[model samples]
Target: MTEAKRIPKRSEMDPKYMWDLTPIFESDDEWEKAFQEVKAYITQCQALQGTLGDSAESLLKGLRLQDQVNMKLLKVYVYAHLKKDEDSTNAKYVAYNDRASSLANDIQNALSFVVPEILSIEEDTITQFLQENEDLTLYRHALDEINRQREHVLSASEESIIARAGEVTSAPSNIFSMINNADMKFPRIKDENGEEQELTHGRYVHFMENNSRRVRQDAFEAMYDTYKKQKNTLAATLNASVKKNIFYSRVRRYPSALEASVQKDNVPSKVYEQLIQAIHEYLPVFHRYVALRKKVLELDEHHMYDIYVPLVQEVNMKYSFEEAKDLVLSSLTPLGEEYRDIVNKGYESGWIDVYENEGKRSGAYSSGTYGTPPYILLNYQDNLDNVYTLTHEMGHSLHSYYSRREQPFVYSNYTIFVAEVASTLNEALLTDHLLKTTEDKKRKMYILNHYLDSFRGTVFRQAMFAEFEKIIHEKVERGEALTPDSLSELYYDLNVKYFGPDMKVDEDIALEWARIPHFYYNFYVYKYATGFSAATALSKQILEQGQPAVDRYLQFLKGGSSKYPIDLLKQAGVDMTSPDPVRQALQVFEQTLDEFEALVLDK
Candidate 1:
């Protein structure tokens, strides 16, 4: 008899497969030492609070000290959090992570006086300071950003109070993370070969994409059924989160939480509204794509579980990690040698945690600060979707790489608004490369299906999620409480509107809101849609226009937060302020859908 499968523990994995966190700190003991030193820096920073507006030199000195403390704080915080994410059930790292989070609040409380004090200085004096101190000129844009928030800047003591409230305000997200990552357990389900396999957050997607309807249905029901059991508790956590956003926005004197969030990116809230409008206009296009999927699969009734399975089942494209890396590198050759070389370096230099292990986080992301390698965490499965996941995350890491290499630490980090563009652009380039290279009809059809699904998930579905966030927050703003039933009902309705009548919006899918980690993020999912739109346009330019386009694109990656996200995209050859990019992306989706229909239907 064969043994049942189980997830391997972190220790069971080979050293080469793990990320080298030693670069951040040689060991946990070293990290603890750094942690103690940062606590001292926080005290020192608190001493310099009221001195920032005294003179240009004082202002520069205060700013530099704050930066110095933040630089160290970032390393300490990231190391602890990454270790915690590696194994959420590990009690040692959990305590370390909690303390690190509190340390972050302490640092924020320490430095909260800096912004209000800078805003108190006279405009003419600040200008003169810049003129007198050349070193102070580096913060020209940063100062301007602060001045723009002058209305929201509170008194020093008031700001400190809010800063210290950070841990309380962030509690909902933290609780959700712990429950989702460590406490939640999914049931075992049978795989395609009829062997019992434990369903996991990492394996859920793999099962959803299985060709067998029985397998897909079983996994879908099992996943959501688990969430359903905790639906009320999950609802309370989400309610607390929405209330948190409302609290901060009101405290900061913004009109709404949505406006407050966009203001940080220096983005107008109208852009967010415009993205939803454009997707609404193109809902028919998405509906048509769904119709085509149904016809191609020859299914009598299409459920949400049926949405993810590839239309071309004849070609189940799977790749080993090494093969996926090579394909991603080759696909990115159009970006010039330097860009490709950095991606190669990231692959070789221990910048990635390659596989999912017991208690590790699910999903993939690129994370780091200025001084560290832009590390990627991937729960890799040997499938084509995971290949796209690899490319997408490397897009982010490459953006981090370029920005850190080129910009000052002050400007090294980009906003969440423009972050998705780099990642989605990589996906587009990979799709383009695959289409051009594949001569076989089935493989090409398969590639088109993947591209179409990427659009549906990123643009249409995320826009749907964006709308849901807006609605839920608006309800909270109006003093309505969100119960499990109401939240599930609202989510179910949105799914129906977005998926169209041809698709069956299953009851199980309504509990999806409980499983999503992004909903806790203040108005963040919308950027995924906008980023997809911008990337579709930018990738077209790079493929069709060549070197000049590549040069412009490279410059955009290195821009960091030096310019507003809108202006950065303008430099990359797409204007996200208008609906043109979103429309252009939909047009590409239409074109792909048309071709896909011709091939599969004709065959």
Candidate 2:
């Protein structure tokens, strides 16, 4: 009997691989000290609430104070949440996260008067103040953003009441996070060696990509079965989350949750709608790719689990963490030496948590705030997918790196609409590098297959999610309750529509929504699709046009929230307002598919 492989406990991880948090806080004791001090600042923020409309100096003082408190608050919250994500089972850090969350709500409530107070001031008065005070000019854009939402801004008391409920409103996402990361259990499945192995969120992808059909099917059933058991509870959590979106949308006077969400980034609802409409037009392109996967794999009937395995599986393209870093650095050469050096610095510095451990969060992200290194968290597996993930996350961290260096703290964070652009652009560059460098037909096919898979996952799949979010929100707005069966039915139907009739859409795949954390993100998944489209266009420019294109892209990264996301992308040379980018990306996918099929038929 083979002993099942166990996840390493946090205490057992190598010290060099773990991120160094001392840059943010010297120790837990220091974090504690900062926590108390920020609590004091939160109270101080409340003192300036009534003074914003008094005079220009008073308004500037209140605004500056708000930035000071928020910067401090973000630093504290980032540290706590990162610590919590390291190992959610650790009670101490969990408490730290909870406390930080509560303090965040307190800070929001304390400063809630700022927006309404600003709105209360006559627009001509604000114009005069900006003209009179050079310091106030710094916040002209920020004030303009506030003024743009004048109809949405409630009275100060009402705004404060809503802000105080932040924690309560956030409860659904928090509960789902705990359940998905900490409490849920997956059944053991036999690996390729026929030895029993425990399934995890991090390991599930590797399992699906396993060469053995039995392994893939077993892991698929085990993964979905686990979620199936808690379907009702998961449905309730999702229902609560959707309701929360609706509640806030109505309170803020938005027409719907989708508008409320896109409004933050100043994106038109048509952008979201256009993505779905474009993908629908390109469904045949995706269906053709699905048919190719079926024919190449030589499967009599293809299941959802069958899609992830490479078409050229005979070539073992597995890579180590060091090798992945080397590949990523080499691939990003088009961006120049300065960009490459920053990636190398991130590697040498304590900017990334490089591997998975027991109780660690699944998936990957780049996270940080002003006055901190943009840190990346990855539950790395030694595969080509993880290599793409490395470059993707590095893209995000580097975006943060440039933004923080160039913009003021008030404009530091980019909108979520443009957030995925930097990340997916790296994935495109990596694919281009591998295809250009690899001489062997098999290796090239594998890279091509992976690129297409990236498209399938990022564009087709996420657009499906975007549609799901839209449908569910609309349904709930019409007073329809989202039951477990209804959610599963709707999800299954979407799968059928997207994947086409060539593949067998398994019943278990219906429960996949139960496992996705992005649905909790409130219309967030569509950006992955839109961003990938924008990135595909930009990657072409960078590759074909050279240094000039790179200059424009780097500038876009540095712009942050100083300009709207659409405007920033316009500066970067991609006009996302049109459907051309999506259609252009699909053309690339089809051209690649044509080449892959030629290789197959010639063989």
Candidate 3:
């Protein structure tokens, strides 16, 4: 095996390989100019605050100005954050992002008065305002969305206080990351050849997938033990973060913290409940899969660490970054020529930061503002994983491109409820393409297992996480102690329920929740589960129905925040409020498991 190369500094890379920040702002000096101009707009918004109640004309002027401010603010914030992500250690960009964040808060606080004032107007009068000004129809949906939040909308002062406190409330998440990633260290674990390898977070995934069971066990133990040691501290940070959610929920008159979180996306609590209930219905399939894993791995005693080890360990499938790009393009052809054209642009243009550098942000994400093309951040390694990552982020970029092109700024951004659908849909399409194209038996089995595992991870595991968050938050709400032991105990039981009786529920595995950054994300994991289900259903539609389904899916990509997420998905042909999509998704998982079992029998 060849030695891995160290990541290069940002300055050392070819400019063409990097995302073109010039499209956002030509220079730092220009960025500075826009930053000051946003300040003036913020002040302009403040001037129009009380005047919204004066007349329809006054309200229209206020809203139009507010939209301008929102657009400018998005551009400025995204530009700085993109530069900051390129090199997190760069003090200049760090300061740039920090200042951008503060400016965002300023704008939020300044504009906080407008909504409450608008809501203060009589509904009939507001309707008359809209009737009198035909031009104001553009903001009709926008206003209706805000007016729907009438009960949740606090007083101007109260909202201003909350807006300003946003930075303060988010500190626990920042502190948790600092401690979890930067401060803690895991013990070295002996590799298959008996050489000590230092266990880092990145290496943990590789180690978990190692062929040697001993190596996987050692790495798991070391990683969890490190987390176990800090459980109390981690719990405290997580608890405070939960409290922040509860605090906002209480003040905003929401019935629960989960409600407060999901309601922002206009998603019904029933969607969240349906996900958990639907996954519970599919637990038997998971049990069967686990039983089969125990049999196929041929272990005398199955353990938690054995789960990630490949059932077929001999296949060494790898692809170069260039190859990954080609595969992604071919994989997405079901979406038709126009959609594929946008993807080709993504490939030809510098829409992706395709490789890791010394201080680049970890993992991958698709990000952009209304005025610019979507940009992707990726720590790309040349393999099947990177290919999937490429397609996933490209899904997001294409979604943004269509939305921005089709809608105004106010409706150009989609919420998290629908955001994951595009990315996961891309993965599903890519997986089908790979399966159809590959003829090698070993590669087929590997891809088959990979597809099953992806569903398991995205749908089932995230549902378990959603359940855990619900349990912990309810415990906190009931005034129960959220000690390390209590949190671990609940988490451990969920693991047992999720993975089933075939695999040992290792005691150390209880501390697994301690290190998950998503718990602090407040009911966010459930979206991954729901999104996968929706995507599975939609991908099947696009593949089978061809042109008609492709048209609906493209319309969905362009819908953005114009409607509630549930409504948007319904228009896209997945009714997430019902359990049908989840049912279909789990059925697909079972089918994949059956296929895997047949392959193993042949072997």
Q: How would you order the candidates by lDDT, starting with the best?
A: 2, 1, 3
Best model number under lDDT: 2
Residue 54's lDDT within candidate 2 is 84
Worst 10 residues of 2 by lDDT: 42-51
TM-score of each: 0.99, 0.99, 0.94
> Which pairs of residues have clashing backbones in candidate 2?
none
Clash count, candidate 2: 0
What's the lDDT of the predicted structure labeled candidate 1?
0.93
Ranking by TM-score: 2, 1, 3
Count of clashing residue pairs in every prediction: 0, 0, 0
Tell me which of candidates 1 and 3 scores higher on lDDT. 1
Q: Local error of candidate 3 at 455, Å?
A: 0.9
The model with the greater lDDT, 2 or 3, is 2
| Model 1 residue pairs with clashes | none
lDDT of 3: 0.86
Model 2, position 324: C-alpha lDDT score: 96
- Give the per-residue lDDT digits (tens) of candidate 3, residues 196-242: 76676556766888898889989999888888778888988988998
Per-residue CA lDDT of candidate 1, range 83-151, in tens? 999899899999999999999999999999999999889999999999999999999999999999999
